[model samples]
Target: MDEQNKNLILATVLSFVVLMVWFILFPPPEDTGTPTAPTEVVQTQDGITVPAAEEGEAGAPSLSPTVAQSREQALAKSERVEIETEHLTGSLSLTGGRIDDLSFTQYFETLAPDSPMVTQFMPAGTSDAYYALFGWTPAAGSVPFDQLPGPSTPWSVESGEVLTADTPVTLVWDNGNGLVFRRIISIDENYMFTVEQTVENNTGSEVRLAPYGIIARHGEPTDLKGFYILHEGVVMSTDGELAEIDYDDVVDLPVDANERAAVEKKTVVENGWIGFTDHYWMATLVPSPGQAFTAVTKYTQATDTYQTDVRLPVVAVGPGETTSSSTMLFSGPKEWETIRDYQNDLGIEKFVDSIDWGWFFFLTKPIYMALHYLYILFGNMGFAIIGLTFAIKALLFPLAYKSYVSMSRMKKLQPEMEKIKETAGDDRMKMQQEVMALYKREKVNPAAGCLPILLQIPIFFSLYKVIFVTLELRHQPFIGWVHDLSAPDPSSILNLFGLLPWDAPGPGSILAIFSIGVWPVLMGVSMWLQMRLNPAPTDKTQAMIFNWMPWVFMFMLGQFASGLVIYWVANNCITFTQQYLIMRSQGVKPDILGNIRGKTQADSK
Candidate 1:
């Protein structure tokens, strides 16, 4: 086949692979786990669960058994200690000392001015309950259940009233049996909260218990994107290895009889953290770096709840000994900078991996860092994406220059190729031999033109995952009608990019296929312009395929994140400029207008 045919095939295969592979993996691989939910709990992971502690040492604030309740009712059941920080605001439930009412004060649900703030950690008993509860999992027969702080143990404010960056709060609960439990909770300027669990053992006997942290969600996230590209379930890091378990897979974990939940447990000899990760937000239990712990992913079938637990080493508290354990909870948007700081400064192992960087993390990480800095520099995520395209093009310039020069030389040899074709008419072997000889004589590689695009394949998917998964672009605006960069362009072609007053079909509707957005249309046009820089292929099939490839890609990506579409358009425009200049330098003026008008090289001559 001719160079045009190669280009045509390369372009087609590249686009399809990107689409399939970057949903991370098409139909994602089936995980190795029990296919069905655990029937009956026969055994539990060691150090995971213990029998009910004796009823919360009688006098401590006690509540009736927990049942489903509205968020307001749940909040009302326990007096809350308000949490205040620069980026976070929530409350600690005094009843359970749970960080159960958190919301990002800076992030909103929509572009509307009155949009509610993005909330996380709704109180337990609420329909969409999510919370981080910390306490001890007693060693079997080590201590009475009531002696340790359990989910419903009411805590009295022992220190600061409101938890803040400047004021950490300490809550205390005594079992009256000789165990006095104190929890000191502190938050930094960002999202991480450090909880120190201290036990004052007064009894003459020794108490053995393991401190544990739990992040439990009543059900799957209501806003679960369920997009194969995004992970909306349990994400954990064990001893430098990262794992993501979908809600379904978590349910399939081997059953633990004592906990009556499907449980998957791994002992992390050193650093590890575990929790649920949404598209933009996450809530995780981060143990101190180098702290060995048992990481558990659990799904309680009885309550339809999903949980990630970090169980610390068991501590032996002798009479008059005060033992303590410290762990952290990260609950908020998965901002690259914030998570990175925790990883680099505070030493939370691979915390930034908390964002789904996908398989192309090698490229995604750097691309995101560049985009993040660009956003900070420009104060606009859309511009940051465009800057990112420029950066990538810059990096690939040497290769792209060679590819364009090769294409330019190929165009110059087009007339000779036509003569060769005429001379060898129907003698396919002779034609192939002559073409190869011509390429060798001219020092031109027929396949060199594909280098830049081939290189673009991974970069394209990497950028897609970065823009689609990062929180930096969420609700960010570029220009008009593109209010949320992480979302598809809201402008619709059915209405002439919103020239019509009516709203276009939403992404959920079938009509969405016809609802190409303004940015995607521009992407198509840019792609067409780039392709036009070279003469159309003589083969009608290849010509038709090349003609439609851009528009086809445009529609396919119309429903994708706007930031990615912007990046593609920028990339195409840059490539067009580079090719136009390089070809002009090589002394072959591309007849772009003629190509756009469907004029082949022969017709142009």
Candidate 2:
């Protein structure tokens, strides 16, 4: 094979190998678990039944019996502290003082305007019950279990009538043992809620207890997207190190003899946050920064629940003194700006890492930032994406210029290379040596053509990650028939470009490969035109492979995010223009149209 063909094949093989390895390491998670009805048991005064545990156990506080009820039934069972904000509406259950019921006021379950609001959290007694509960665990022999407010403990609204961004609510629970436990819940204009718990030790003795926050999900979300690129389970950052624990991994954890879920704890010496992240939304506990705490993630097999906890260090309150602990709960959409604000303004270490930027975070972050700024400037994400493409091409113009110049030089030297091959027929080493000598004498780099492709791999992956995982891209519109850039192109050519009544094949289906969309087809044409900038390879195998590559890529990337497809199509056009101009600058006029006509005639022959 010729040097150009060998390099092209090597590049193609390497690209395939990289993709295979990436998929192998992070394949889309399979929906593996079947939902089983939780066994019902007697209800306790606290509303839900709690299994007994040994005193002073430093683990998940206690397991609550499963209660299956509708979301309305569960909400009606408890007197709630209404939560109202410009962007959120939910109620805090007074039963456990849990921030349970929440819904985004702006987002909907579907694109239809009448679709129900996106619900984020629900209290116990509901299927897939998810809620956040905060309280203190008393030290053994220091305070009785009953003395501390349990999950069922009734809390009276002591301060505010309604909880709004400006108004805070305080729930008071008096143990009647000279200890008063007060919780002050305050919210912002966004989704963050600050919960401050104070215990007044009027018992005439010192008492020790640890403040703990728990976010529990009864079962894996039934609506989990399960895509490999997006994280949909436990995500935590401890002392700047982040971990994403999938639900399946949590379920596979080793259990105790009692069948309790195994607990995995990481000590955060400085600052951290722990919680659950959905595809677009998240609920996390942000403890006070600059303090040591224990972060725990566990799955309870008995209750079929997944939980994340932030257990602060034990504190002792002296007689007639009050000790207070504060934590922030973030329960809302994973908007980049909001999360970044929390990370910077609130000093939450690595809080923005919860967005699942994948392995190319360094590239993805800056790309998203530039895209974000451009969106702000252009007032359209589609334009922002196009602007991003222009910016990227400009930044890489120098390298592209060199690469195309070298390619033009190589094309000019093709005759000399062929002559060397002929004279050194069947002598591979001599052919290679002569080719090297020719390349050096002509000041051309045979490998320069590969630079642009090599650089594009990471850039492509990063853009894909940004479009796949960021909330800003969700439901974003570009142009006609492209209402959601984060999703695959909806218009398919198979049904006469939606002229027919039949629907396109769904994603992940075998037939989906053939359901190429308009953008993908355009991308394929652009790529093919770029390939035709040079004459077809003399070797039949090489020519055939090159001919098929553009179509293969077209189908392979048809199901990708529309934003990424747009980027690819744009890149191909820019590359074609760049190579054409650079080749002309080198005085080598590329006969693109002639090349196409010659290839057609040759094939016809």
Candidate 3:
């Protein structure tokens, strides 16, 4: 094979291998038998034992079936302190003083205007019970569990009629002993909530207790995308390092023969946060930046529950003294600006890293930032993406120009190359040597064309990551039939572009392979036209591979987000224009019509 053909094949094979490995490593979840029951009692590193269920409280069975309940039914079970803010609307449950009911006022479950708002936290007693609970755990011998407010403890609103950015709410619960516990909950204009818990001791002696926060989820969310690119499970930033544990990984942790559950804990001596992250929303517990804390992630086999906890240092409350500890709760969309603000302004370490930037974080972060700024400038995400693509192309224009110039030179030397091949016939080594010498004399680099193509791979992947994972792209509109740029093109050729009433195949289905969309088809055509800028390869195998590659890519990427498809199509068209103009400027006109006719004749022959 020629050098150029070899380069092409190598790049194609490498790209294919990378994609295959990714798909293999993160296959879709498979159906499994019911999970076994968790043990009755689960112990943490802090020596606190949590029971699977309180007496007479309805709990999930050992092999319980997946059940769902209405949001109203779940909220009606507990008295709640109403939560209202510019960006959030929910309530704080009186039982356990958990910030359990939360919905983002700005986001919805679907693109439809009437669709329900996105609810991030759900109170217990519901099928998908998830919430954040904060309280104190007495030292080993200091006080019993009943002495402190437990999960079912009822707290009364002592101050503030409603929880808002300006008006904070305080819940007070007297332990019916010498100790009284008060929690002051305050929210910002965004999603951050500051929870301060204070304990006043009136007894004669001192009491030692450890303050902790727990975020518990009864089971995996039914709406989980389960895509490998996005994380939908435990995410923690401890000290300076970040760790992510998927739901399956947590459930598959090694269990002792005597233990009914598995738990993993890490001690962070400085800054850290722990929580659960959905595709676009996250609820994390952020402790004070300079304090030492023990972070734990656990999965109970019996209850089928996933929990993350941060246990802070033990505090001693002396008689007639008051002790207070505060924690920040983040529950809302993972907007880059908002998260970065928390990281920078709130002093949360690596808080912005929670967005799951994947392997190409360096490129993805900047790409997303540029897209965000352009969106702000243009007031349209679709235009922002197009502008970003144009900017990237401009930035790489030097290399692209050099590549096209070299390609034009190579085309000009085609006659000389043919003469050398004929003179050195039947001697492969001699022909290669002559070709090399000729290239040197002509100052043409055979590898130049590969540079632009090579550079595009990383940019393409980073753009895909940005579009697929960012909340800003969700429900964003472009043009006709493209209400959601983050989703696949809704106009499928199979349906005659909406002329037919039938819908395209659902994602990941077997028939989805053939469910090509309009943007993908356009991308394929652009790629084909770019390839036509040069004559068909003389080698039959090379020509055949080149001919089929674009269609294959079209189908392979058919289900990708429309925004990414648009970028690819735009890139191809720009590349074609550059190559055509450069070739013409070099006084060598490309015979695209002749090339097409020649290929058709070869096929007929």
Candidate 4:
């Protein structure tokens, strides 16, 4: 309809298209070393599948691939055995470190019990350790497949290592070179398993290295519920006018294993952060703000093969020195305090996704904290909201008083303004000149009435963000019927069949909705009465604009949080009471109260 609206729609369309493309191309790569259905194993002349053992079978392994080879060539003349690198446990094999699913849980119904990623990442489908959000590569560069034989040595694990909380066992593995990698795993009081890994180069020459991590989501993308996912650790508003797709839809990226060539062709990041997202909830692994990190998706194929490609934060490291990284996994309900506590450690609080108040946070945070304390005392967020609103109104009462007094004094001078309008005829500019001169002589500041309204904008926006994103109010209930202030009212119904989109929530026990309808009507009635008491805007267009604000606001804000509606209703009622008291041109009068009572009755009808 307008240039702004058109641009907004275009921007939204472009964003969704990009997000769609990214989603398809960036399938998570998780390699679960288990072979999907072994097509064929090394076979003997007897037609038996050799080399590959059956499930649960134990074997004494030998380094030579041809253990039972024909006794030809006298078994290489029985040469003296020598060790290249002493075999030991190393970094857990990442043959299939791919994320299969992602989830977040707030309820205790799941085993993780209010943790976001309980079922998704636990019970690893392929390996013991999961490396996520990091990318992998051949140590020096791309290794020539022709130059190296696959699996001359297989990564190994020992089950009887006996790892315990008191005495964690060391894991060692040879990296096909003289180098040995070591790591230790231990259980913590919180019932969490923690592992620390270190790479040691026993070889005289420098060894090559590749770094990565693993994460998973258990089900298909859309089937995953309650959990919200963030792309590259960024979440945007997905509702209202802000709804959009982050991946470009016109072009899809190759996520299937067959598209492996596409990955090699594209430049991948070396390090960054990636994780599952829950709305007011957060599951993130953030590096220091200035430090760079890569966005990686580990995709596992049906064959149980997985690989990781960096999407961002690309870097490289050189020999000998250890490059250490930390991954702090959170599987709990989204609590702002808890999230904030870890902001410094992992920057996880950034995932809490609070609306940035910018410079206004200095003023608003204190006010919000005080309101939160009151909520704690009352045990009702709705009451706390009401109390905070009134307190703000009371603090600004003097300013509001000045505004109403100026308006009232202007009402007495309306006849003069009207005379100016009449004499000036249709020359609108000349009429304003006369009105300003009259106001200047009367010692009235025409703009003084606007300061209160200006001050409320930031306050209004800050409260709106806090209400929408604050975990404190996620499932909090109010009196009568409203529960889960963070979610839309379940009782509200929409009849899309009508197509005009005017379907409203039917009258229910919700004080919020009821108060909303009643408050607007009250505000309108108060405005009409105040119009009769105070001078109207000098310009007819300006007066019409002011006159229309309440109705427009009522329609737009009808379904808003009951808490916000209550504040407006209270503020209006208070303003009306104050206006009526001060309008009599003297001390308290019976007529003023009688007029207000009549207006209230008329409005109720």
Candidate 5:
């Protein structure tokens, strides 16, 4: 094969390799069933907080190794202040003054009408005991753990009965010996909560304590997606540096001998937050914007806890002095618009990074912006994907135009090139020299045709990552038979599009790889038709590769997000039109139909 054909085949194979190997290498992590809730119990305090590293060296508070109660039973352990906001519902446990129970009022666990609201935090005793706790950590040589309020501190309502956007709740606990603790929690119309924790010291001596916020997940999330592309673990921003540590990596964090847990700690001067992020929802602790704090991530295998803590600097209170610390807690869905608003309005630096944009952020971010606007304008994700494809195609139209024009010129040179080959016979050196002279004389480049294909590789991968963003695409319906664009195309040919009584194969079933859905089949056809715009390769093996490529991708990607499949189909159709127009402008009308028939005849022969 000529160098041009060789490059074309290599590019095609490389694209195939990337598409196939990515999923193969990084298949979803195995689901080792959510951290088993403590099965047996002795003192049912829900769960105990593991001792901290030290009073001075702040570390995350995690569940202690012990048995637990069910979520309802755990919630019942403490007197609670009911939380009711526009977008959130749940209660704050007065025991720890912890916002341990919350569910998104706007979202459901599934598309079904009866599906439960999506729960973001569960009480300490639940199988997935996830919660956010704010309290005082005593300074060195200060009061004992019991003296200051903790995860299990029993506080009584000091103010509001029900917590609402307009009505904030206050809980107070007095040590009686010398210190009194009060937590005033106020919720916004959305997800943010302002927790103002104050401690009044009435003792004769100086008292010192550090305020902190802890987000603890008793075990890995029960609803963990475990998908490689999606991040579901400890996601934090320290001094504007974003870090996404998986649950496995959290477990592997360096040991903090003082804390007796695997810990990673960072001292952030300002502009940071720490939290656990599941696929769609997140619970993060954002220190009062300008406040410096020690951010820590911790994991304890024995207790099966993953924790992130934001510990503020130590504050000292003189005799009869009172001090308070205000912090923000975000516990809700990761809506791009909402997070972006928080970042822009409240100066939550890089808060949007909590959403995994992946390595292709350069492309993914811009593509997501375009797609996001399009979704809003069109009011349908399917159309948004197609609109995104068109916007991208239009942006690259000039390069595509040049590529197609070059391909036309190369086609014009084919006849002369064949004569040169005939004249040179078996003299390979002479044939190459003549071909190079012919190309240089014509002022044409053989590689231009591959630029569009080369560009598609990154764009395709970026869009795939975008679909995994979840909030925009999850449970979103596209045109018809596509209930969830983030999920696979549901209608399968194997079930004759539901004509057969049997249903399509489940996504996890091995047969799902071949359960070609309508969208995937249409995508394959679009790709095959696009290939027909050019004459088949002269080499039988190369031609065979080109012929089978579409079908190979169809089978391989049938299980990908249907939104991506729609993008591919749109891209193929647009490309086909562009190439055809460029070909016609060159006075060589593309006979795609004839080429398809000719290929069939030749293959049959």
Candidate 6:
């Protein structure tokens, strides 16, 4: 194919890939949903009934707790209810029955003052997973939780309500005495405790019930203050059944409730179960599946602790039939010694589903793991990235070297090939045959250069994924003005001088910006250096076409992770050094460097 056509084809393909990546990272808002679907449970004659549609809606809860006023007032009144035990020390709120504050001042560092670090779960409002019902709704009035105008009247506290140190107190609410509610508190060496909420309908009639629970946040979810982590585990069949489901093979699970024009969402898990976060994490799971028509919803979060809320929406029962639902709440860390507290495999680790890599995972996973370990060990992700890239380059050295040698040989034979082209003049078939025959006799492999580049493509993709998702590199620091290598570069002279986006960073930070800005410059320089060290295409079109390749690559790479950019920068530098050494060893003149001797030699030539 002619150089013009190749460039056109490559340009089209590049544009398409860019669009796809843009959409993947910044998907349409409509695509977001909760992790768990709304659950609907019904008992059939043969077994349990669960409608997938109902389950889909489990995440979209329109009902929020009735606030006395607005969220600002509630937050202002968030009480610091402290509980002391050898096993646990934290503060919760009596107002929202949530952990409004947590401190291990003597146990652990303060984390931070404005840090939204919670001792209990605090779900991200923007994330489509485990959405918590808090803040305030229209019914509570305008002004959000954070923007509430001012404090409102305090909520009335009933007398004799105290969270004391003694036999653990239990919080109970029953419909027997017009839905009486009570609070019980306790302390112990073992903070392990079980909360059993029993709801029985005794109005001599069936009444619909929606079980809702609330816990306060010592902090809210924020991008700046989250500890990135994952859960891993397996699910076993019925009690002692011994049968297990391989949760390793990932399936797309719901992140939030599906919203439809008129359809109701539901989810049903017949096998009663529980869940636990990693060892340091604690959680409370409330399972309340009411009568035949009950729809139950479960959600959880993590801070310094974990809070799981189970919402049960019950429908009417037959007049004569007494209906009841029970929920067991387990709250504690997932420490091996304590995880067993919430047995039935709840404590078992279940890794979050990740994107698959086809057959490449077998090879890429080890590389990723190695890089991750190094990142954690050194606490400097940029260095780890450099090391990983170097390892990959070393492994592929033989192939790349052969490719370079082949290209060099091709360049040496170019004069002869051009003579044949001139002699064949317009006889395309004859020219092609001559070119093939020359390649055959010379023992040249046309594909020798292509294989190495193709092999590197997958490796590049694999590393991209690793850098993008590996939590270990999230906030890791690096040396000399470049800290938090996982995030965008934090230093930018252009930005400092107001010539760029004030939030804009140096080349390593924002992938897209860096690609469009710094990548092209580096790539151009690298490619120019490479060209000077080796063959130059005879055809002006081919030379011009190849000259533009680096710019195209730079645009493509600019929007990649800072770690990836650093790797490329190192790769280019190393490649330039290698090619320069090769040219020097081959007795090639160094006119490209423009030294006084080089200039004189070039002038003489």
Q: Could you tell me every candidate's TM-score relative to the true structure?
A: 0.89, 0.90, 0.89, 0.55, 0.91, 0.54
Q: Which ten residues in a row have the lowest lDDT in candidate 1?
A: 38-47
lDDT at 221, model 2: 92
Cα lDDT tens digits, model 4, 1-605, are 12244345446645644564454334455322332321111111111101111111111212212222221222122221111111111112222211212233233222332433232232223221122322222333332221211111132333324333344444445556544444444433221233344455444554344433334332222222221232211222211111112222101235533232112112212223334443443333333234333433333233222222222222233345554333333433456555455544444334433323234566656666766788888889878877887788788889988877776566566667777878999986677777778888988775666678678767776676566545577667766546655543433323322343655444453333432344345445554454444445555654565456555455445555555555566666666676666654422222223232121111110
TM-score head-to-head 3 vs 4, winner: 3
* 331: Cα error in model 1, Å: 1.2
Decide which is better by TM-score, 2 or 5: 5
Pick out the ten consecutive residues of candidate 4 with the lowest summed lDDT. 41-50
Cα error, residue 460 of model 2, in Å, equals 1.1
Q: Please write out the lDDT profile of model 1 over residues 523-574, one tens digit for every residue.
A: 9999988998765565566677778878878877888889899999999999
Summarize candidate 3's per-residue lDDT along 328-413 as a digit string, tens digits: 88989999999999999989999999999999999999999999999999998888988998899899999988988887777666
Q: List residue ranges in candidate 3 displaced over 4 A.
A: 1-27, 30-69, 254-260, 415-434, 508-510, 596-605
For each candidate in the order shown, give its overall lDDT on alpha carbons: 0.79, 0.80, 0.79, 0.41, 0.80, 0.41
* Candidate 4 Cα lDDT to native: 0.41
lDDT of 5 by residue, 1-605 (tens): 36666766768796866768577445766655346555321111223333343445434444345566778888777788899988988998877788888999899878998999988888876677778887777776787666788876778998999999999988999988889889999988999999999988898889878888888777776667787778888888888899989888888889876676788888899789989887788889998788898898887566677778888888889989999999999998999999999999999999998999999899998989899999889999899999999998998998999988887776666567767868988886788888888889999887787788789889998999999775889899987788999888888999898899998888678777789899899999999888876555544566677778788888778888899999999999999999877877776655467542223211110
Alpha-carbon deviation at 527 in model 5, angstroms: 0.6
Off by over 4 Å in 1: 1-67, 422-430, 595-605
Per-residue lDDT value at 136 in model 2: 78
Writing each residue's lDDT as its tens digit, candidate 2 over 1-605 gives: 34667866758765895585466345676674756554321212222322222246533334345457888888898898888889999899888788888999988877776889999998777876788887777776788767777576788999998899999999999999989999999999998999999999999999988887778787789898887777889999989889999999888777644325566878899899999999999999998899788888877665666778888888889999999999999999999999899889989989988998899889999999999999999988988988999999999998888888888887677667667868998887788878888878998876787788789889988998898889998888899999889878888988978999999887666677689899999999998888876545544566677777788788777877888889988988988998888777776766566542214211110
Residue 480 alpha-carbon offset, candidate 1, angstroms:
2.4
Residue 95 C-alpha lDDT in model 2: 82
RMSD to true structure for each model, in Å:
5.1, 4.3, 5.2, 14.4, 3.9, 11.9
lDDT of 5: 0.80
What's the C-alpha lDDT at position 181 in model 1?
Answer: 92
Candidate 5 wrong stretches, greater than 4 Å:
1-15, 18-28, 31-36, 39-68, 414-438, 595-605
